[model samples]
Target chain A: MIRQTLRMARWEVIKLRRRWMPWVFLAFIVLSSQLRLLTEYQMYSNADPGRIAVQAGPANEEGEHSTISISCLDIRDGLVESRLSGIPTEFRQAALQEVESLRDRCPALLGMYDFARTNFLNNATLPGSLSYGINMFGTLGYLFVMILAAMAIGVEYTWGTARQVLAKGCGRGRFLAAKVLGLLAVVGIGHLAVILFMGISSLIITYTMAGTGISTDVMQWLRPGADVVKSMYMMLPYIILGTFFAVLTSSASSGIVISVVFYISESILRWIIGSYLGPDAARILISVNTPLWMASLEFPALNNLSEIYNYLRDFLSTFLPILAYIVVFWGGSFWLFKRRDLKPSTGV
Target chain B: MMASNDLVIKTESLTKRYGDILAVNDLSLEVPRGHVFGLLGPNGSGKTTTMGMLLGLVRPSAGRFSLFGGRKPHREALTRTGAIVEFPSFYPHLTGRDNLAFFQEISGNGDSVELDTLLEKVGLDGRGKDRFQTYSLGMKQRLGLAYVLLGDPDLLILDEPTNGMDPDGMAEVRELIRSLGDGERTVLLSSHLLHEVEQVCDSVAILSHGRLVVQGRVDELVRSLAGETILLRTTDNAKAIEILSKLNWVTDLNSKGESILVSAPTLRSSELSEVLSRSAVYVAEMTLGHVSLEEYYFKITDDANGDTA
Candidate 1:
């Protein structure tokens, strides 16, 4: 069985390598990442360093501060500002008042003010380089995982290769297993290639643009080595779930549709449940939280357990439905694929 | 008792239905090993369905079949059986060699020599590198045959193997199939061409409306038809007809431009010659023409309808 699986995997890899589409997708990911890094680097390097101060609070140190400074904006705030500008002024004013009240009660504001004052005097700015790397790696992980899953068995049907394979004495079980392994292998290789490409290019871009003499040790976080590995581990369940759908579906279109629906349904359900019910109920019903719970317990950082727990709780609470989706969709797809007939013609 | 190695295919009351239409009725037939067996049928016959079932592609509504002595489709059975049911399909984007390589891997047969030899046998030697999409229809058909020969299967089941081939391509495929049947391999070839079957097959089964109308050795079946047709050509064509017309055994007597044709149940040329000689008509030539297989096939299939009525 292992020998046969390897043979099938070899053939699948050959097929995938010969095709232009997979390579094109990989190239697109790398190119998009580089482009993003370039744009972000330009924006950061050209900014007036004196204007970029870390705002603390009134009594601490910073004499005066501009509201438009980049530090004042979290990612979510920037996104909301860009997207919700058309909303009526009354609603915006009400939301701003709520934020101000919360900020007034914060004890850390004084410390933030002190840091901002020192940083402004030193002419320092928060680098946007890491943001580009994160965006690129995250986007590739999402796209590659879904694309690989959608095409794994779906390509066989599209090309009529499934009929030829099945006719050669392969049962449904072995065939699906081979397909799942083959797809994961190809996705892995593609992911690794993109990681290498993005890592090297980002290093070059960061060194050339930022002119930061920071050693490799400090730049380790920006490197794709650890992050890509971690992201791939996180994506393993999704890839398996995606492959299940691809095999169960008769065509690529149906597989993609089913995968998207499964992914979306879980998030929607988790939201509805978490919003109306309690976090405990949401945790039980969702999957996103489970991984955070696992990660929190497994990986210890400089932060205390409470901090880790809080992060995990918040992360899992928001993402629980996705995990539920992975399990249910993967299980259902596996069941259907194991029973469906491998027909002689390529329907799609 | 059937010989252990004799029967290559045996189906028991195999039936397949599509909605209200019974595509394959409760049909059963046995194809003996080491013979070029022909499955003769008209359009919409169950030839394709039966082949599909044997190849493990179509599910039989009722009944089952054993391929290469196996009671059901098992790994052993599939390993020893090669089939081309209906139209052959291949990956349009890949080269013929790549396609064959993929099939070889799937079959798990380590014999590369056989692949090369089969490619040569199918007249697709160096062209294996060429993409299948670029191949002509005949080339595709040949490649399809090459695919079946991958594992050197014991039984070769082909459905209308020469469906769209030109005369030359048909002859090539026919010869290849014939060469494969050197008393070691069993070939179940289906075709609507009666003359082609008569030329190559040792045994035949005729199907009409999803039922076996008749089946047996080709020569015996042809010889056993109720009325025999004889074509006669003579110097005195006029005298030959007049003499033949007097015989009560002779039914229909028609004359071509130079020869006369007659259908008779029991009439010999000797008796006809003696009668013609007695009537002062000189018999220059007289011989009995054997009935062609096509006529025999029609006679038996037509008899089936009459018997039902």
Candidate 2:
């Protein structure tokens, strides 16, 4: 079984290499990340660092000061000017409580504010592109990995290759196992390639646009590395879940539709559950604790300010549920393939 | 009874059902070692479904089958049995060589020389490098045959192996199937073409609506249907016709041209000759017509369907 599965895995890799899916998805990520970095640089270039554009605020007699003004040069400086003490009494209490919560959660950023005062803001910073790319990685990576993984497995049934494989004496469970392993390999290799490409490209862009010296900040380094690993961990469940749907449904279109619907609807579902119910109740959803929850790593404030992560880390750091979801999806797929007859599938 | 090891496939009351539809029902059969066997049935007669069950692509709803003398189907047993059920399906993006190489690897026999030779045998040697999708249907079917021939399995099950082929292609495949029947290898060929099966197979099983209608040696099944008609060209045709018509065993007699066509229910040509010679009407030529597989197939299927005609 192991040998047969390895052979099937090799075949799947060869087939995947022959297709445009992985390379195209990887290229899209690299190109889009670089382009978005360029766009950020263009928008922030030659700005008056001291001028604070307050998009909204309460109307007051002393309008400019009543509306908070923070320098664009540093987020720390801007956040200080955003202190709740200056707010009107009506909104002051609520704002202070939120700020107090954020201050406690993001101790690293707040602690390093004094040291980061000399650094330039936005795209002028050396690690700006890398940070921005890592920020966008989770959501975009989720969509790409889910779509391609579903299509890869689902095409076997659509194209009738699954029947051929089983007819050749490879067991159905082994065949599905090979697909799961093959998907993991593709996901691992594709993600590694995307990270390396984006990292190197961001380095070049930062060196050319800003100066040569890069930030040595621990959080800056730790955040991207953590995000990269977390994004991979976050992607495995989606990949497995996508494949599960593809095998169950036996149609790429159905798999794509099901996965995309789940993805798009998860955030809405999380909101509805969290709003009416509570955050604890909402976290019961695997989707709530997975892509979106993991994607919150992209925004420092979102991860730090939300109490969901706090509650999550209490139970083996919230990995138990995600791991269980992966096992269920993968095991369900294996069972389905093993027991179900290999009918000539036309639609799904 | 033959030893169990000498039988390549044995199914005991094997059955398969899809929802309420019984695709294959209580099909018990034995394909002995070293003969080309034909599994003949019309469309939806469960030919492909039974093959699918044997190949482990479809699960039986009840009963069981053994491959290579084993009591249950397994990967190792199946590795020795190659098959192409229904249409030949392949990865269109890969080259034909790559497709065969993939199956060969999965089969784990890892005989590259055999793979090359099988490709050559299927007349796809030079064309193996072309993408499968680019190949025509005939080329694809040839490649499919090459795929089954890989690893040089002892048993081969082919379902409609000549589907979508021209006459020349069908003849080529028939020859190919016939050639696979060495004294040590068995071939179970499922087809709707009676003539092809008759030309190639030594033994055959006819299936109708998921049940085994009849199974035996090809010649035996044909012989069991009816005796052959004996045609004789005599110098004195009236005398020969009169003598043959008067015989008690001669069921029907017709005179045409300078010959007498005698439907001998059980008598041979020599017996007819004795009567003709005794009647002083010497036969210049005598030919005994063999019952064709086509005729026997229609007769049995019609009988199975309870058709009076």
Candidate 3:
């Protein structure tokens, strides 16, 4: 059975190799990185240092108007006047306080921006924009990867290739299992490409626009790397869900449609539940639970889990629900695929 | 001629029920080793359904079957068997050679240079690299035949193997199937093309409405029908018919033009010759014509349906 599964998995790899999916995936990531660089460059070149500079304004002292310089966060503090000026003043203090708590964060953003516009100005470091790029992947990359997963399984049925493979004595479960592994293998390689492409692009853009002043802080570099890991953990369930819907509907379009609908509906459902029942109660939903799990890792204050009696409670709350989602979608797809007959769909 | 132990496929009371409809009912069949066995039936006669069951695609509603002497269907039983059920299914985006390579890998039988050779065998030598969707229907059918020939499986189950083929392509597949039956492989093919089956199969089973109507060696079925018709041309046909009608085994005697048409259970031209010669009616010509499988197939199916009606 293992041998059969491995063989099926290898076939899946060949399928991706022979098709346009992997190339398309790579092209998409590169294009997205380029777009990010372009947007960052535009924002960097347009930045007016005067915005965050102390401005003399009419001050009311004893009901008399007098010129006084407003005190504000300074560029000398190694902060970008552009990104900071956009923050609403009412929340400016809070945001600054948060940034101050992570002292090494601002220089990286500022240096990344300056290096994006000037090649010799600053040296961009590793994991600079990869942290942000992976976050984007979770949304945009999620959709593309889901589409890939859907096609991986959907083509087998639509083309009647499932019958051909199954007729070779491959168990249904084994075939589906191989497809899932194949999808992961493709996604894994795609993720590595995204990281390398996005990471290097971020460095080049940062180094070109800024100067050779990027932080050598190992801890900050490690944070984005951790984010990549977390995003990967989150991606597995989506791939499995995509495969499940693909096999169930027997069409890649339907699988993509259903996955998007389910994802959006889960978010909507979480909102409705949270509005009526309370935020904690909304955590019962996977859409709420998964993001909240990531939040607990990124921002402990979001869920107040830091005050929980057991330190492991927050981890369990997040891990179990996502694990359950993986089990239901992945395991359920295997079961259905195995139990059903190898019937071909109406189209190729 | 192969022994029971040499049977490649054996089914006892194998049946399939789709809710209230019996798609295949009480099908008991034995395909001996080294013979090209044909599953003959008309549309909706359960030929494809039986093939589906044998290939483990359809779950039998009742009864059981064995592949390669095993009493139950299992993966190991299918490792040495290849099939094309219904139509030839392939990935439209992949080339024919890639499609075969894909299955070859999944079969865990390792790679062989036969991939291209099999394509050539099916008249797809130069076209192996073409995408499957670009091919005509006949080309697709040939590719499907080539796919089954992979790994040199012991038993080949093909359903309507020549359904979409042109005459040349059909003849090519017929020859390929015949060549595979060279005292080593067993092919269980199903088709509505009776003449094709007659030309290729050593033994055949005719099915109608999920029931086995008749099954035996093609020659035996034809020879069995041969004894029923005897044509005699004599000088005194009227007297000869009268005398032949008196025989215990003779029936359905009638006169047409100057000749007599008769149905007899035991037809021997020698006996009739002796009887006619002794009666002083010299016989000029006497022949026993055999029924073609086409005629025998329809006769039995029409009779069965007539009885049902």
Candidate 4:
């Protein structure tokens, strides 16, 4: 049984290698990472290193904003001028507080702005990319693997190849399991490809634009291993969910639609639930806990049983729901695949 | 010639139902080892459904089946069997060689399969490198045949294996199937094509409306159920019927449209002409031929329908 499943997995990889979908995603990620870098480079070059900048635009429109930079030397004068002008009365009090705050830490915003941009640019590099690339990966890996998982299962049904393989004594459950295994293997390879390509491109583009190799003093530099593992761990539910949709509908397009919709809608629901209903209400969802989990990857030394217990509690609280999602989707996939009759292509 | 009590495939009251509709009903069958067994049926006769249940592609609503003596669908039992249910399904983007290689690998026969050899055996060697999508339907069917022949499985279950093939391709497949049933292998072939099954199968089970209508050796069924019919035009139709009716060999005698239809063992048809001549029911025109599976199926269907007129 083990031998049959592994062989199925190997064949899955062979088929995946010949296909265009996963490679297309790899190219998309690698190229888009650079485009993001070039855009960031433009913004970095436009602002002086020690300038305080406010990004202002209509609230409804995002990515259509202009930065109003205030040099460190003119910080007080700019606040005073804005206050004395016919700004709203509410702005006068805010300006007064801001001016006082700046008096004590006038260069703080300048350093923060520079660090934020440079840290992001440094993501294209190795140790930096690991920490930073995981974030990039985290933001997009679900979509990447969601598509991968869907195609891996969905194509088998659509092409009528599932029956072809199953007829050869490969168990239905085993075949589906092998497909999931193969999808995960492809994702691992894709992650590496992203890292390698992102590193090389960022090095070239960052040096050419900013006159130095992408570098960062960011704390994430020390956590490459944790980042990669967590990024993959975090994507499990989405990957399984994608499989659920495909197996349930027996179509790749349906898997992609429902999974993508679930992703987008859940993010929106997280904000809505967090705001109107409260954090406790949002806590049950994957969207809320993923960031919480990502943010709390570090633990203070387990100096005592109390601290260790607390850490474990917090970890389980976040991890258990993800486990539940994996189980449910995984169960759903197997239930549908095993119980229902294998039919010919229902199309995309 | 390879007939035996050792069955390669046996189904005991095996049945399948989809909601209210029965797809395969109480289909108890035995395909003895080392014989090419044909499952003959019309469209929607549950042939594919039966094969699906055997292959574990479809679950049986009731009853059970065994492959190579195991009542359950164990890995070893399934591994010993290879099947094609319905049409040949393959990944369209993959070349023929890759598709076969993938299935062969999963079946645990990866290490030894010479894909090129299988392709050549199926007359698809040169085209094996092309994507499945590029192949014509006949080529695709040929590839499907190659897929099942992998690993030299002990039992081969093929459902309409020659579907969508041209005359040459069909003949090639029929010839291939005939050669494959060479005593060492058990083949359960399903087809609606009567002559094809009659030509290739050593024995057969005929099914209708999800029920086994009849089952026997092809020659035996044709000899008994598919009784020979001779169409004759005589100088005196009344006298011809009177003469043929006296002979025990003449199972049926009818007259219509200027011809006397005589049903009997057509091999003894020479006696028919001789007997008619002596009676002066002189044969003006005569033809003798044995009934094929094609006729027996229709007759059984007619008998089952029962006095529709």
- Taking every candidate in turn, the Cα RMSD to the unseen true structure, in Å, is 10.2, 9.4, 8.4, 8.2
What's the distance in Å from true for residue A248, model 2?
2.2
Score residue B261 of candidate 1 by CA lDDT. 66
Order of quality (TM-score): 4, 3, 2, 1
- What is the per-candidate TM-score for chain B? 0.84, 0.81, 0.85, 0.84
**lDDT of each prediction vs. the true structure?**
0.68, 0.76, 0.76, 0.78
User: Can you list each candidate's DockQ?
Assistant: 0.39, 0.51, 0.60, 0.60
TM-score of each: 0.72, 0.78, 0.80, 0.83
lDDT of 4 by residue, B1-309 (tens): 223248788887889998898999999998888889999877877898999888888899999888887754566787778788888889888899988888888877644347888899999999988999999889988999988888888899998999999999999999999999997799999988888998999999988778887887888877785347787888888988988899987877767578877878767877888998997777788776556688777777666556422
The worst-scoring run of ten residues by lDDT in candidate 1 chain A lies at A119-128
Model 4 spans > 4 angstroms off: A49-105, A108-114, A117-125, A205-222, A304-307, A346-348, B1-5, B71-73, B110-113, B226-231, B236-259, B263-289, B307-309
**Whose lDDT is higher: candidate 1's or candidate 3's?**
3
Which pairs of residues clash in candidate 4, taking residues 3 or more apart in a chain or in different chains?
A: none
Whole-model lDDT for model 3 versus the true structure?
Answer: 0.76
Model 4's i-RMS, to one decimal, reads: 1.8
lDDT by residue (A1-348, candidate 4, tens digit) is 788778777777778888898888878776776676666657756655344444333333564644344454466446445523554455445544554555566567567666756655565454665455556656666777787888788877887888878888788888888988787777777667766766676566656654456445555555766766776777777778889989988888787888788889888998899999999899878777776667644575767887778888888888888888889889989998989999855542
* Candidate 1 wrong stretches, greater than 4 Å: A39-43, A46-49, A52-152, A205-249, A252-348, B71-73, B111-113, B226-264, B267-289, B305-309
Over B1-309, each residue of candidate 1 has an lDDT whose tens digit, in order, gives 477457888888999888888878888888888988999888777888888777665678899788777755565587677777665667767888788888888878847777788789889998988988898878888988999888888888787788778999899888888888877799888988888888878999888888888888898888775346666666688878888898897876767557676677545756666776787776664446566898778766776767756
Q: For model 1, what is the alpha-carbon lDDT of residue B156?
A: 84
- Span of ten consecutive residues with least summed lDDT in model 3 chain A: A65-74
